[model samples]
Target: MSRGPVDPRLLQLSGPTRRWTAVLAVVTALRTVALVISGIIVGRTSASVITDGTGLADHRAALGVLALLVVARTALAWVEQRYSHRAAAQATEDLRVRALTVLAHRDPRTVDRAEWRTLLTEGTEGLGPYLTGYLPALMSTALATPAVLLVVWFLDAGSAIVAVVTLPLIPVFMWLVGTLTAGRTEKKLMTLGVLSDQLLDLVTGLPTLRALGRLSAPVAEVRRLSDRHRRSTVEVLRIAFLSSMVLEFLATLSIALVAVGIGFRLLDGSMTLAAGLTVLIIIPEVYNPVRQVGTRFHDARDGIVAVDRILTLLTARSDGDTTAHPGTTGEAGGRVSEERDAQDGQGGQGLTVTFDHLSATGRDGPRPRDVTGTARPGQLTVLTGPNGAGKTTALLALLGIATDGVTGTARVTAGPGTGPRLTGTELWDRTSYLPQRPVLDTADATAVGDTSGLSLGQRQRAAVHAELDRSRTTGRDLLLLDEPTAHLDTPNARTMVEALRRRAAEGATVLIASHDPLVTAAADHHIEVRP
Candidate 1:
């Protein structure tokens, strides 16, 4: 249960982030070499000043080299910052797209829309500081810290011993303090989610609240949530500041131990002045990366939480999953995915899907209970039922999603010469499902941006055409549509009905989940379910 400071899942998710992190590690290693060189230059210069009484003029070459190293280090740091930020932005965008894709396919009843807004926007933004700040610091700590320690050990064994003795304290303290911050960070994120959800509800439901005379209720609740959010933020900041202080104190104390010991060794003539100075100059380098990591950990905690949220979403079970459903038959996991045989052409025969006692419970109640029917090629099977009777649910079941509360069995068998069954996802593999929400406004809707001017009926008509056209092109044997003509006029509806029948006659399984009289009347076979 104890995860590393960096989540491996994040690196796996964003290739850009991973690539940038590798770049950062390489840059940090170069910086480490530069740091050691600078330390040696300064130390030898000091030794010349004390032992041989040389002035600044005597070390001109060393000074020049130091200046060049400084410039190189500065440029490297700049590159690290620039690329790290760009990588963070790319990483955030990629992760956001991924989260959206998964959430979009998921059942609306299973996922919260308000939560999606937060996860996609605010939650993802948290990754910016994490990628740019904490991730680089982490790489630096992993690479630079060890390189410096090795250089110090090679230079002076006694100083190396001192470093070895005190080095463990920094991580020890970091671990203890980090434990405190981790809980605080999680609590803060939860409080923020609550606050965001409440504000979104208040804004969206303002009119409803006013009409119901309950505006004051949520106003008061918002105030309460705001207070909770404020307190959580303050607590997180307090823990962050305290952890930074603790880490800095440990680092400073560790450096003091090494430096003081070197100074004493120099005075006692047990160590050369050059070696002592070198050890003194290089000692802080050992602690710097660790110190930076400690401070950046707080900045990255929000991103870590966002990663957790995204992974959860990615792993959530699809509602009414056919593979997991006891009532459903066929191989598990195939209900969601399958590749139809490439041999099927657009003119190929339709596939048949048979349902027997197929039923499932919706969020509101049970629906499509005990429905039995067979949809054959060259026929339109219209499953008509009242609202809340699971017409949509039945379609989803056939598609092999949302396994919970699902019972009975649905199977897909190929029509004559439809080729191999698309069983990887089983029935869903060969099906094109048009959900009820997004109706297209034109066959070429992509050319018509800003559809705010288009009416629902226009969009609905366009959507039906688009879906049917897509199915035609893809040669999908099974087409599932939820209320395809819900927004069409009588003339349009009749045309859509004739089109459905025509498509069926051409050898495709057409199943319509609708209550429209036009659709029901055109049905070659009808199955009606009651609540």
Candidate 2:
């Protein structure tokens, strides 16, 4: 599906963010108040001295007072940024956590590795402006612009009238300019996404590409994407420069017109010099808010686009199947409050994972071959298959990660009186899947497994063992491995196999997917898939 327009629904989706936005609203209001008050004081003092033609009776006093207020304004600005950044970081964290939880439960077949990486890594980071900058900007526009105009109206009705009437023209021009490049902006963002995906693939496959003498092509592609990004940025800046010129011209002209009228009024003895000068000075101050809004509008536009993607990811549906068994939450945290009912007892059942008649097709390829498998307690079932023979797909189906293209039902069954069988996340608690290419979040290195002095193989084994330990402690009872030996040498693979079998002997169901005969030979049950 094509990327759709940014919907206000992003702001509406998160209750916590909306509530906190009220806090930002207060901050923005204060910002507006400070801006308007400071502007008025500056305008009034400058006009008073200019119109009165007075020298320094108390110039030092006035300068010192204005300096103090300026210092206060700067302090307020600092505070606003401090709190806004804190709030933005919190909002980003909340959205990222929720998105990741949803992603963990999603069927991997539907959301590929590239998409997940972009959404998780880039999408969350891109949403900074919405909470910290744009939200406050919109708030200030709504709160301060009108009040500033009212002050201008009180200072001089004629200038105020013109300022108020012409102020909306700034937003209108901004929208017009922004619209002219909206398509280009979106196209650029998409290009960046693809570039990001390509760079990630290249980095991950760098060793293989170098071995095969294929590194130059990826390097060329990176250079091309970078050049395109540079051009897009240049185009955006050109538009920005033109838009800024328009705002400046309009603001200057509007203020000048007010000054001319006030000049005529003062010469005609229709108003005091002080009052006419005050009105003249306030003219520019009135349009200042509108001018700021126009500039910040672009940031808000990008923020909306980023937030649209974030909300889409968060709200997408996923099949809610977990492998946790009945008579308990089947959750990893072990908050189950009740013992299994007598009828729920699954004597020696341990766990039974069955994938029945599953099939999937890839991008522009033949329909996926049918795959079937089962894993039972006290037994090690190894699935041996060539590349693309559906071994990984089958494992994912059993793990509930390939639900998108799964044509038939898969179920995890427990013996009688073990409560109803668990599947999905419940099953997840009872199982640990070590993918062929594991993507571990390094943010919590200690939580996944200790990494000190460990080689790649040791790290992988430690992660697997850590999951096993965590499961056993949390009342989980199954483990699944995809290509457990793919990246390891013969010796390390053999060692891991022995460790895996020992876990099986301890009543954990272990299922291994591999192309190596060594892994299959050690298995209590072996299922081979032929292309």
Instruction: Give the clash count for each candidate.
Output: 13, 23
Q: Native-vs-model 2 lDDT?
A: 0.65
Per-residue lDDT, model 2, residue 126, is 50
lDDT of each: 0.76, 0.65
The 10-residue segment of model 2 with minimum total lDDT is 327-336
Model 1 agreement with the true structure over 42-62: per-residue lDDT tens digits: 999999999998899988999
Judged by whole-model lDDT over C-alpha atoms, candidate 1 comes out at 0.76
RMSD of each: 4.7, 5.2
Q: What is the lDDT of residue 424 in candidate 2?
A: 39
Where model 2 places Cα greater than 4 Å from the true spot, the runs are 1-10, 13-20, 34-72, 112-126, 129-133, 213-219, 299-302, 317-343, 361-368, 416-419, 439-444, 447-456, 528-531
The number of the candidate with the highest lDDT is 1
The reply for model 1, stretches above 4 Å from the true place, is: 98-117, 198-217, 309-347, 361-365, 375-382, 413-430, 439-445, 451-462, 483-510, 514-526
What is the TM-score (0 to 1) of candidate 1? 0.81
